[model samples]
Target: MTDKPHHPLTIDGEPRAFFGRRSGKRLHKGQERLFQDLLPTIEIAYPETTLEP
Candidate 1:
C-alpha cells in the first residue's frame, strides 16, 4: 500500500468544514484494502481534483 493523505469535507450551505488528515505514516495491506473499499461509498468526488505533495 501507498501513503496518501485523505481529507473529508462536509458540504453544508457553503461547503462547511469537517474532518481530514494532517499527516501520517503509511498504511498496511489490510488498512489499504479497507480504505479502498469504503472510500467509494463515503468519499466525495469533485471534478478536476488533484493532489499535490
Candidate 2:
C-alpha cells in the first residue's frame, strides 16, 4: 500500500485550487486593528519597469 499524495485539488469550472478552511472564529479587536493598519504597508505591489528605468 502507498500513502496518498498531498496536493491541492480544484473542482471543475473553478479558476483556482479549492482547499483549506473558508471560515473561522472572528478576529479579536487587536487582530483586526493589526490587519487594517499593517496590511497596506506589508502587501506586495508590482512596480512599472519603464518608470524605474
Candidate 3:
C-alpha cells in the first residue's frame, strides 16, 4: 500500500514513527510573552571558542 504524503515519517510505504511536526506558526500573545521571559535565562551564548571537528 502507498503511504500518505501528509504522513510524518514512513519506511518502505509503511508508517514507521511519529516525530511531531515543528511548524513555526506565529505564537499567540501568552506564548510570545512566555518566550520573551524565558529566552534570556535559557539562551545559549555563541561560541567562546571556535567549533572544531
Candidate 4:
C-alpha cells in the first residue's frame, strides 16, 4: 500500500490557515456567465451597525 500525502492542518501552529490565492485565475465560460447573472442578487449589503471581526 502507498502512503497518503500529508497536508498541514494549520500554519505556524495557528488554528486557521489561508489556502486560497490572492490573484484569481480566469473562470470558465459557464462560470463567468453565472458570476455576471447571479452574483448581484446574492451579494450582501453593509448593515448600519459595525460588525465584529
Of the candidates shown, which would achieve the greatest lDDT relative to the real structure? 3
Q: What TM-score should be assigned to candidate 3?
A: 0.31
- Candidate 3 residues 1-53, lDDT tens each? 43566755455666667567657699999999988998767966689899888
Candidate 3 residue-wise lDDT at 7: 59
User: Model 2 RMSD to the real structure?
Assistant: 8.6
33, model 4: CA deviation in Å?
Answer: 1.4
Query: Model 2 segments beyond 4 Å from truth?
Result: 1-19, 43-53
**Candidate 2, 1-53: lDDT as tens digits:** 22434543345533455467757899999999988998778966677664554
Best by TM-score: 2
**Each model's backbone clash number:** 0, 0, 0, 0
When summed lDDT is taken over every stretch of 10 residues in candidate 2, the lowest stretch is 1-10
Ranking by lDDT: 3, 4, 2, 1
Q: How many backbone collisions does model 4 have?
A: 0
Please give the distance, in angstroms, between residue 49's alpha carbon in candidate 2 and its true position after superposition: 14
- 14: Cα error in model 4, Å: 38
lDDT digits (tens) for residues 9-33 of candidate 1? 3454243454676578999999999
lDDT of each: 0.63, 0.65, 0.73, 0.68
Off by over 4 Å in 1: 1-21, 43-53
Clashing pairs in 3: none
lDDT comparing candidate 1 with the true structure = 0.63
